[model samples]
Target: MKINYSPSKNAFYEEEHKERYLLSGSWPGDLIEVSRDDFIEYGGNPPEGKTRAPGPDNKPAWLTIPLDFVEQAKAENKRHTDEANNYINEQQWPSKLMLGRLSDDEKLLFNKWLDYLDALKEIDVSGAPDILWPTPPAEPAS
Candidate 1:
């Protein structure tokens, strides 16, 4: 993500100076190249670790995009939409809460998993695996 920082506006301050980021304008070397004009004129003029402040009118500009995350998020959203549509069409809408009453077998299965989900809500699962949850224990053979 790209962020633009400039001096405050329509507010009160103790002092006023040129915007810091406006002059620095250090873009990621991989992404942007400093213009020849900027290099010749503003190059190293500020000196080692020089600093400045922005005036009331100074406002910075920035442009950026999350190239990878955007694609991932888009894919995940499409998947969710497809899943929701499929569920609605095939299973039909259940009760507001986990559907209404179910057959004895269905009720037993739902309760068993519902308890597990509820238990999960009480714990942290940030690093949990995506599948084969509540992993089975290893077996010991003779």
Candidate 2:
């Protein structure tokens, strides 16, 4: 029937739901009438990555929430970190073999992997979404 938006909370409130769930919470915005279909399309008041905005005719509108590059970068950083961690986890045992057990070439590859992991740590992902992922070392032979 009618939807109101709270800029402070970045939430949408249906006149009915507001009274039921958020009796004391502030739901600020001139109530705008929208069709039931429109309400469902907005996913119960601006689903993640979206926010409500005033429509051209003073109806209601939804727009994409601005991309958070810093958060994106952090997520990218974590992804790369996790990948490297898994690689090292799976491949490090061969490096721990008894001394002289590994051929010279095998040791070199393992060391290369570790070096890549170290380089990854030094990367500044605060600039995330623009990260240059380090090249993984060639998987070493066991």
Ten-residue stretch with the least lDDT total in model 1: 9-18
Q: Tell me the whole-model lDDT of each prediction, alpha carbons only.
A: 0.35, 0.63
Candidate 1, after superposition: displacement of residue 83 in Å? 1.6
> In model 1, which runs have C-alpha deviations exceeding 4 angstroms?
1-60, 92-142
Please give each candidate's TM-score. 0.24, 0.42
Give Cα distance to truth, residue 61, candidate 2, Å.
Answer: 30
Candidate 1 lDDT over residue span 1-142, tens digit each: 2233324421111112224423566322222223344334332323322222232334322213334444554454455445444543453324523556456654454444445444434432221211123321222243
In terms of TM-score, how similar is model 2 to the real structure? 0.42
Model 2 Cα lDDT, one tens digit per residue, 1-142: 5765444444457777766555565546455555667566754545555556555655456765557865776677678778877875675545465555666775777678768878878876543444587887766356
- lDDT of residue 15 for candidate 1: 16
Question: Which candidate tops TM-score?
Answer: 2
Cα displacement (Å) at residue 126, model 1: 26
